[model samples]
Each structure stands twice: as C-alpha cells, then as structure tokens.
Target: MSRFLFVVLPVASHLNAPLAIGQALRAAGHEVAWCGPRTDLRPLIGPDATLYPTGKRYFRLDGETGMASVRTLWEGHVLPVNRFIRDAVDRAVADHRPDVVVVDQYALVGALAAHRHGVPWATFCVGALELTPPDLPGFGDHVRAQLGRVWAMTDLPVDDAIDLRFSPYLVLGLTSTALTGATPLPARCVLTGPALGHHPDAPAFDWAAWDPSRRHVLVTVGTMAEHLARDFYRRMMAATAALADRVQVVVTASPDVLPEPPAHVLAAPRVPVLELMPRLDAVVSHGGLGTITEALAHGVPVVVAPIRHDHPTVARQVTDAGAGTEVAFASATPADLTAALTAVLDDPGYREGARRVGESFAAAGGAAAAARHLAALAARPIEHCPSGTAALA
Candidate 1:
C-alpha cells in the first residue's frame, strides 16, 4: 500500500476536498496523513486522519473590497505562508517519506517540497477559479509575474511556461465544467467534481417541525462570510418576513447576528445543510463554491448575492448555467430578495436547471473519482530526480 501525504491550508473550503479524497484513499488500504495547522480536523474529516501540525494558521478574513483584497491575499497571506509551509512540508517528507504528496493549489509550498524530494505529487485545485483561462490575454501573464515574486521569496524554482501552481503530473479540480463554463482545461487538469465530504458532527433537527404547507428556503452566508453578512442577512430576514404567509426561512448564522428573528424565520449558528437540502425548495447564499455546489448536488436551486473574491464570478456562472439567479449584494433590499426568492421558487425551470447540473456533477464522480485518480498516480513508478535540485540534507 502506498502512503499519501496531504499538505493543505486550514480554511474549510481549501482543506475539505483533500480530506474527503484522503479518507477514500485510507479506506482503500493506503496510509493517509495531513500536514497543516492543527486546528481540529476530526469534525470535518473523521478521527482516523493522522495529523502533522505546521505550526501556523492560514489567514482568514471577510468584508474586503475587490482589487485590494486580492492583493492582500497574495501579499499578506499566500506569500508569507508559502515560505513557512515549504520548510514544514519538507521536514514532514523527510520524516514520514510518503509515496505521494497531495498539494492544495494555495499551498504551492507543498508542491515545491515534493519536487525537492523527488516525490510524485498531484495538485488539488480547491476552487474552479484557481486556473487562469488560456484565451484571456494578459490575465495569465499578470498572474505569473506575481507568482514569480512569490517563488523567489519562498526560494523555490520557477517554471516560465504555465504557472507552477499546477502540477505537471495531475491537477484534480474540485468542480465540474457545467458550472464553471466551457473553458478548455490544461491536459493534466482533471475535473473530479465537488467534494461533498462526510460531516461527523452533523446536528440533528426535528424534520417533523418543518411546515410542509409552505415552501422552505435556506439562507446562509457560510462560516467565513458572516463578517460581511449582518446587513445582507437582515435584508434576507426582512424579505422572508414579508412573504411569511407563503414562505418559511431557515437561516444559518450566529445567534448574535439575529437574536430576535422574525416570525417565519429560524436562526442558528449551524444547520445541517446537507440533511436539510432534500427538503429545501431553494437556497439563498453568498455564492461560496462549497455552498453552491452542495445545494446543486441535492438538486436545489439557489439565489445568490455575491459580495467579493470569487463570489461575483461564481454567481455569474450560476445564472449562465440556468441553475439560479443573482442580486447586487451591497444594494440588495428586502423587496429585491423577495422577488428573487419568489422567482426561484415559483419558476419550475430553475429547479429543472439545478437538477441538470446536479446530474452532471454526479456523472463527473465526486470524492470516489478523485481517490481513484490519486491511487492510479501513486501506483506508477517514481521518476528520476534532476541532479541539482536534491532534497535538503
């Protein structure tokens, strides 16, 4: 059995995909372990996972604007973490000596370490937007210029052609082409669909309590999104209250955000979204990739209010895919939300579109397909390492 080592960032969206794939690999009789900040993986990834702490956390933030935030992510978070994690992963490789290293796209440091060690590695593209579209003029050039600076800071070798963020062997994308548009992927990039991993701490709720008489809509801005969500959620709650007679809203937010929810609303810090998806008529969210795909996987349509980062792009994809609708997040009012929710619920086409996309996701093969691909890569013979770039002694 081959040993697989995963190096990932601690954010839920970044780490979740690899956790699911690793669990599948372990179940298939391979040894699996993770290297990252030890911020508790048991709740999301189960208790059997072996942890190797990297002694630092990936920076988490919200409520930031466009270009500035993008710059901050690369300058403040990505670059600094790359330097720290490269050494951590290199040490882990020397000690554990895993057969293959699975590297998160953001955690490019892991890829560098694996390359230095002459180990075969796969790139884990946690988000669909991680790849630069080949046809976009100047987009690829601009990103590579910045990435070169990051490589220099982290003391890693640079490849001039395509960004080294993608692995030469394979890049397993967590999303499918149906929702991400028909952009042609690099030859090594494989779409493994979304990773709807098992949630061990799933909260049990009274399903019987849900009012079958009215259409159910779930409102969420995701865990990290709450920082920018208070006003947005207030509008959502007000909108749901306006349609109280015909619609019921179940909101996933902190208690402090909405201590006194309106008559037709149920507010909680955490809701078992997967369990609730089957019964939900629609979802209202911040257009997070994980939430969007999760709702789609259950064949439920969405009403997205994109805030920042990849939100606007993902929201546009949803509209283009015919799975849902989008609204201006900052200016959205109760009336606007009410109208969007009504359209998503009242129009049968939205549900049909969601199901079509969901069907595509299933066909793409979720975690199991990713695991199979990783297993195949690990089974292949190890390639000869170039003489100069040997592992640090």
Candidate 2:
C-alpha cells in the first residue's frame, strides 16, 4: 500500500476536496496523513487520521476586490503561510516518508518539499484561480512568477521546466469543463469534478422546519466572505421578502447578521449543506467554487453575486454555461438579486443546464477518479525525459 501525505490550507473549501480524496485512498487500503493546523484538521478529518500540525495562524483578505484580492491572497496569505509552515512540512516528509505528497494549489511549499525529497506529488486545484481564461492575458504568467519567487526564497534552484503550482505527474482539478467552459488547462490536469461528500463537522439542521409548500432557496457567501456578506444578506433579504409567500429563503449566517429575519427566512450559523442540497431548488451565493459546484452536483441552480478572489471567474463560468446568472456583489440592488433569483426559479432552462453539469460531474468520477490517479502515480516509475524534465513514465 502506498503512503500519501496531503499538505493543504486550513480553509474549509480548500480542505474538503482533499479530505474526500484522502478518504477514497484510505478505502483502497492506502495510508493517508495530513499536514496543517491540528485544530482545523482534527474535527473535519476525525480523530483516527494522522496529522502534522503547523499550529494556528489566521489570514484575512479584509474585503479586497478584483486583482487586488488575488494579490492579497498570494502576497498576504500564500507566501507567508508557505514561509511559516516550511519547517513543519519538511518534518512531516522526513517522518511520514509518504510515497506521494498531494499538494493543494495554494500550498506551494508542499510541492517544493516533495521535490526536495524526490517523492511523486499531485496538485489539487480546489478553485478556479489557476484556470484563468485567455482573455486575462498574463494572469497565469504572473502566478508562475510568484511560484518562481517562492522557490528562489527557499534557495532552491528554479527549474523553469518545473512549475511548482502544477505537478507534471497529476493535477486533479475539482471541476468539470461544464463550469470551466473552454478554458485550457495543463496536460497532466484531470478534471475530477467536485468531490462532493460528507463533512463530519457539518452542523445539523431541523429539516422538519423546512416548508415544502414553497420553493427553497439557500443564501450564503461561504465561510470566508462572512464579513462582506452582512450587507449582501441585507440585500438578499430585501430581494426575497416580496416572494416570501412562494419562496423560503434559508440564510446561513450568525444571528447577528440577520438577528430578526422575516418569518419565511431560516437563519443559522451553519447548516447541513450536502444534506440540504436535494431539498433546495435554487441557491443565492457569493460565487464560491465549493458552493456553486456542490449546488450544481445536486442539480440545483444558482444565482451568483461574486464577492472577490476567484468568485468572478467561477461566476462567469456558471453564466457562460447557462446554469446561472451573476450580479455585481458590491453594487447590485435588491431588484437585481430578485430578478436573477426569479429567473433561475421560473426558467426551466437553468435547471436543465444545472442537470447537465451534474451529469458531467457523475461521469467525471469525483474523488474515486482522483484516488485512482494517485494510486497509478504511486506505482509508476519516475523518469527524466529527454529535456531533463521528471515525469511518470
């Protein structure tokens, strides 16, 4: 059995996909371990899973927008975290001695550590940030330059051929072409769709409270965007208020955000999202990849109000696929949200689009496919090609 070590960010969306994949590998008799903060990893992964803790550190974007958010993510979070956890990751590798290191896209140090140890590694593209379109010229180049700088900072020789962001062996993109449209990706990249699975830490909700007589709508901006979502939630409540008799809006937020939500709205700090998806008819969200993909996997349509980071890109993909509509996050009025939400609910075409994407997700094999690929990579012989590039041969 091959040993696999997953080096990931502490964020929920980033951790979920790899967790699912790790579960799959374990089911196949492979040993799996994770490297991240213990407090964050323990609850989600359960007590049995082995963990190499990097301790706790919080990284915040503080509501930046567009390219600035991208800069903040790399400069403020990714780089700093990489520097902070480099020693921990090195120790994990030295001790765990994993045959394959599964590296999150943003966790550059994982790839570097694997390379240092001469271990095969795979890239987990949990979001749409790395799948930038041609229209955004130099975006990929800029990201690659950042990766180069990280390597240089480690005093490691920068092999231009080796892009640390992606593994030459395997890259598991947690999305399908249905959402990504015609965006080009790396040759080694496998669109494994979204690894939709159970989250052990998901909070339970009172399913009995749900009103089946009216259409159900979920309004959430995911975990990271809560600060930016207070105003968005206000706008969403205003938008859905008129339709309260016909539609039930479930807002996932702290009571403070919606202290006295209308009678028709259900407010919560967290909800059983996967369990609740089948009951949902439509979702109003911040265009997060995890929320969008999970909703689509259940054949539930979405109305995206992109907040920041990869939100706009994922929003465009959803709109382009005809699976949903997007609105300005900061400036979109209640009227805009009302119209968008109404269109997805009223129009059968949007549901059909979501259904098609959902079918594609099923065909893509999700976590099982990722696990199979990692297993194959583990068994394959790593050889230097004619140009001195290391790859599975």
Candidate 3:
C-alpha cells in the first residue's frame, strides 16, 4: 500500500474533492493524510485521515467583489502566501514522506514542493475554470505576470509549456465535458467529473414541512459568495416571495447575513445540500462549480447569478448545457430571478439537460475514478508521466 498526501486549498469547494478522493484511496487500502488548515479540514475529511496543519487561515475579503477584488486576492493573499505554503509543504514532506502528493489546483506550493523533492504529484482541478484550453486562455497577461512571481519563489525553474497549477504528472479534472463542453485536454488530463463527496452525516432534512404541491427551490450563494452577495440574496428573497404561490424556497444564509424570510421561504444558515438536492426542483445560486455540479448530479436545474471569480465561466457552462439560465449579478432584479426560476422549474427541457449531465458524471466516475488515477500515478515515476501547460489563445 502506498502513502498519499493531499495538499489542498483552505476553501471548502477545493477541499471537498481532494477529501473525497482521499477517503476513496484509503478505502482502497492506501494510507492517506491531508495537509492544510486543520480546523477547516477536520470536519470535512473526518478523523480517519491524519491531518498536517500548515499555514494560517486564508485572508478573506468578505465585502469585496468584481475583477478588482479577484486581482487583490491573487496579489495580496495567494501570491504573498506562496513562500509560506511552500515551507509548510516541505515540513509536511519531511515529517511524513509520502510516495506521491495530490495538490488542489489553487495550491501552487504543493506542486512546487513535490517537484523540489522529486516526488510525483497530481493536480486535482476542483473547478473547470482552471482548465485552460487553446480557445480559452488560462490566464490574462497580468495574471501570468503574477504567476511568474510565484514561480520565482520556488526552487524549481518554471516550465513555460506547463501551467504551474496543472501537474506535469497528472491533471484530474473534477468535471466532465458534457457540462463544461468539449475542450482540448492534455494526454495526462483525466476528467473524473464532480466528486460531490459523501455527506453521510448530513443533518436530517425537514421534508414533511415542504409543500408537496409546490416546486421546492434551493437558493444559495455558496460560502465565499455569501459575504459578497448580500444584494443578490435580497433579490433572491424578493423573487422567491413573488413566486410564493408557485414555489417553496429554502434560502441558505446565516441570520447575521440575511434578514428573516417571509412565510414562503425558509432561511437557514446551512442546509444538507446533498440530501436536499434530490428533493428540489430547481437551485438558484452564485454559479459555484461545486453547487452547480451537485445540483446537476441530482438532475436538478439551476438559475445562476455570477458575482465574481470563476462564477461567470461556470454560469456560462450551465446556460450552454441548457441546464439553466444565467443572470448578471449586478443588474439582476427580483423579476429576472423570478422569471429564470419559473422557466427552469416550468420547462422539462432544463431537467432533461440536467439529467444528461448527471449521466455524464456517473459514466466519468466520481471519487473512485480520481482515486484510481492517483493510485496509478503513485506506482509510477514522475519522469514517466505526460505533462502539459495551459496557454491562453
């Protein structure tokens, strides 16, 4: 049995995929440990896997939005922390020498540290936004320039042909082409679909309270977007209120973030999404890849309003797949949200499209496929693996 260490970003969406894959690997007889913020990972990965706490909590821009905030996050948080994360990875490697390292695409330091130690590492693409095809350039010039600074901090020389975020050994994409649409991928790229993870401990949902006659709709803006999307949440609440006669809404938000909802809406800080997804007819969210794909996995359509980050790309993919509609976060009114929700819940085509994507996800293999790929890489040497970099067209 081989030992595998996962270096993941502190974010929930990013951690969920690797954590699921790690659990699968362990179940398959391989020993696995996670390296990240312990507090953030413990609850998700569970006690079965060991944890190596590395680095401090990430800086969060709660009230920030748009491309400018995106840039600030990259420059102020990600870039500045590269060296610290690299040190942490080195320490983790020294403490427990794993046969291979599995890295979240957002955690560049993991890749660099693995390379420096001459250990094989696989890039786990949590979201499709990081997968840059020739048609879809990976990063803009400004972003690439910032990436160079990150590379400079590392001991290994930068390979222009390979994106640092993508592993030279393996690239495990967490979404299928059916939802993301067909795009050219490197030989090492393995599209394993979304690993929504096993949430067996998810709280029991109050199903009896929901009206059987009305369409059940879930409204959420994801973890990062929750702080940045108050306006969007307000609009959603109003829209859901307008559709009270036609639908019953469950809006996920903390009491501090959102006001008390009308009788038609259930405003909770958290909901067991996996359990609830199958029961819902539609989802309204910030177009986060995790939420979008999870909804699709359950054959439920979505109404996406992209706020920032990779949300726009994921939103476009949803619209292109005929699984949902996209609305501009800034300009979207209650009417727009109400109309979009009505269309998705009313139309059978959207549900069919979502089911199609769900089929693709099942066929692609979820956490099992990802674990299989990582297992294969573990047995092989880094030099024997195929690698490529993403280039902007």
Candidate 4:
C-alpha cells in the first residue's frame, strides 16, 4: 500500500476526478491523503481519506499580479492564491513525506513539493486545452507554443512541462482513450477516462419530477462561469423564455455576480450539477471540460457557448463529436441561444452522439485505470516510465 498524497485544485470541477481516483486507491488498500481547501468535497471522500485542507485559493484567472517567477503553473493571472499554495508546500514537505503525489494539472505546487524531495508526482488533466499539432509548421503556427514558454519561465524544476521528451518531469496527464493526436509525452501518460465519484444529492426539479411531461433543460455556467458570463446569462434567460411551454429551464448563476433572473426561469444558486445532470433532457453550458464531461456522461446533449480559455476548445471537440452545437460567444444573443439550443434538442443526432461519448467514457475504467497507473508510477523509477504512458499498465 502506497502512501499517496493527492493535491487537488480547490475548484469544484477539478476535485471530482481526484476524489474518484483517491477512493479507488483506498479501496485497493492504499493510504490516500488529500491536501486542499475541501469543505465542498467532504461529501465525496467522507471519512475514508485524510484531509490536509491547505487554504489556498487555487488562483483565479482574471485579475492577478506579482509572482513573476512562478507564473507558468497558472493558465491565467493570480498571485495571492498561488502564494498560499506555494507556502503550504514548504510545510507539507517537512511533514507527510508521501511516496506518491497526484495533483490536478494547474496545481504546480505538487511539482515543487515532489521535486525538492524524491516523491513521485503526477498531474491529472481534468479539462481541455487547444494545442496546435506538435509537428505542424513553425513555432508560430502552434497555438500552445506560447503557453509552453510561459510554463518554462517558472522556478519549478520541470520548467518546460510541455516538452515531449522523457526522463522524469512534473505533470503526467491522466487522459482518456480518445488519444486524438494529443501531445506525445516522454514519460508515462495514463489514459484514465472521466473520473466518477459521488453525484451531489439534490431535490428533484418540480417540472421534471412533478410534471414528468415537460422536457427539462438545465443551464449553468461552470465555476468561474458566472464571473465571465453575466451578459450571457441574461441572454440565456431570454432564450429560456422562448422555450417556456416546450421545456422547463433551470438556470444557475453565481450568487453575487448576476442580477435577478427572469420570472419564467427557475433561478438557482450554484447547485450540485451531478444531481441535476441525470434528470435533465439537455444542458446549456459553458464548454468547461467538467460540464461537458458530466453532460455527456449522463447521455445528455449540450448547447455549448464558449467564451474564453478552454471553452472554445472544448466546444469544438463536443461539436466535432456531434454531441452539441457551439454557438460562438460573440454571436450568442438570446435569439442565437434559442436557435442553437433548438438545433441541439430537435436533432436526434445530438442525443445519439452524447450517448456514444458517454458510453465510451464509462467503459474506460476511470478510477481503476488511474489507480493502476499511479501504483505503477510509484514503483518504477521516474525515468523508467515513457511518455504517453507507454510503460504504464
């Protein structure tokens, strides 16, 4: 049994995959220790795992300053939260001294902790990023090239986290079987599908549970969704009105970020999406990997509205798979939302595509696959494992 230290991002979506992997590891008789601000995740792991609750913010993307030396780990700007995690690592290293450290992709603090000691660290990618095909043309042609240089500028030992070479580095992406021309990794990369743990238990929607006849549409901006999408929500509300008699719409927004919702819409605070996804007919969401994965996992189609960051990339993948329609952010007016959503809901192709993706993800043996690879990763010398997880079982 390995003593595993799981460092998860505090963000709600990122936590699910780690918790799922941790639970499976514990069930296999391994000791799992979690470090993060985990009040929201207590229900997922319960008393089975040890908690380290490092009260770091996990950094926000929009407004941040300072930390010029340690910026690569972040996809966006954030200083205070990064500093909190940075300081926490110093303390964690002197104490637990875990054998294996599994972390979320954005949580580079794991790299710092693991590198300083000899602890094996692997980062799990729970989201999507658009990377220009590695072999394509010049460096300028690669969309993700600049992101790589930014990553290498940091003080972390594995500065160039994206280098396709082998010989031990931070961040081993635990991806799915899609393997669709993804980056070639020198070290082992585990293709561990959608991590499934506990779906939040919430009261049934009155429209879906009570009426049972009305098709339900669930609309949500994921975590950080509300921050970047207030205008989108207002327009979405107007679109929801258009579907009034046809579909019962439940819309969620950040508590303080947006104004009141329209009367026709069921305005909810951030609710557990797991509970909501199972009952809904379709989801109107930002193209965050977590939201898309959950929607697809339940065989629910999506109307993907992408704004910034990875949303555009995720929207494209879902669209490519025929699981949803991508209403470009610049054109996502209420009429556009209504029309795009209608296109997704009316088409049988969308539903079938969602189920196909969902079934494939379910068959990938998520938590088990992750546990197998992590256990193997801890046992083998870091350099022994090849990129793309060629050496991982």
Candidate 2 residue 368 Cα shift, in angstroms, is 0.8
lDDT of 2 by residue, 1-393 (tens): 999999988787788899899989999999999999998899988888899999867886477876667777788888888888988998898899998999998888888888777787899998887755424555666677778779876756777888887887789998998887677888698898999766888887877888989999999988887877878888889999979989998989998877898888999988988888999999988988989999999999999998877888898999888899989888889998899999999999999999999999999999999999999998898973433277656
The clash count of every prediction, one per candidate, is 0, 0, 4, 7
lDDT of 4 at 257: 52
Question: Which residue ranges in model 1 land beyond 4 Å of their true spot?
Answer: 45-48, 58-62, 132-142, 204-209, 382-393
Model 2 Cα RMSD, 1 decimal: 1.8
Ranking by lDDT: 2, 3, 1, 4
Best of the candidates, lDDT: 2
The list of candidate 4 runs beyond 4 A from truth reads 38-44, 58-80, 130-187, 199-210, 255-264, 381-393
Q: Candidate 1 lDDT, tens digit per residue, 1-393?
A: 889999888676676678778878877889988888876564665566677778776476745756555656666778778777777788887778888899888787787677777787888876555553323335455566667876675554564543557877778877788887777776588887787766666777756667889989999887777878888888888888878998888998787888788878877788887788889999998887888988898889999998766777788888998999999888988999989999999899999989988998899999888988888888776553543222211
Residue pairs with backbone overlap in model 3: 137-392, 162-389, 163-389, 174-193
Q: Indicate whether candidate 1 or candidate 4 has the larger TM-score.
A: 1
Whole-model lDDT per candidate = 0.78, 0.86, 0.79, 0.65
Off by over 4 Å in 3: 62-69, 133-138, 200-208, 384-393
Candidate 4 weakest lDDT stretch, 10 residues = 63-72
Cα error of candidate 4 at position 223, Å: 1.4
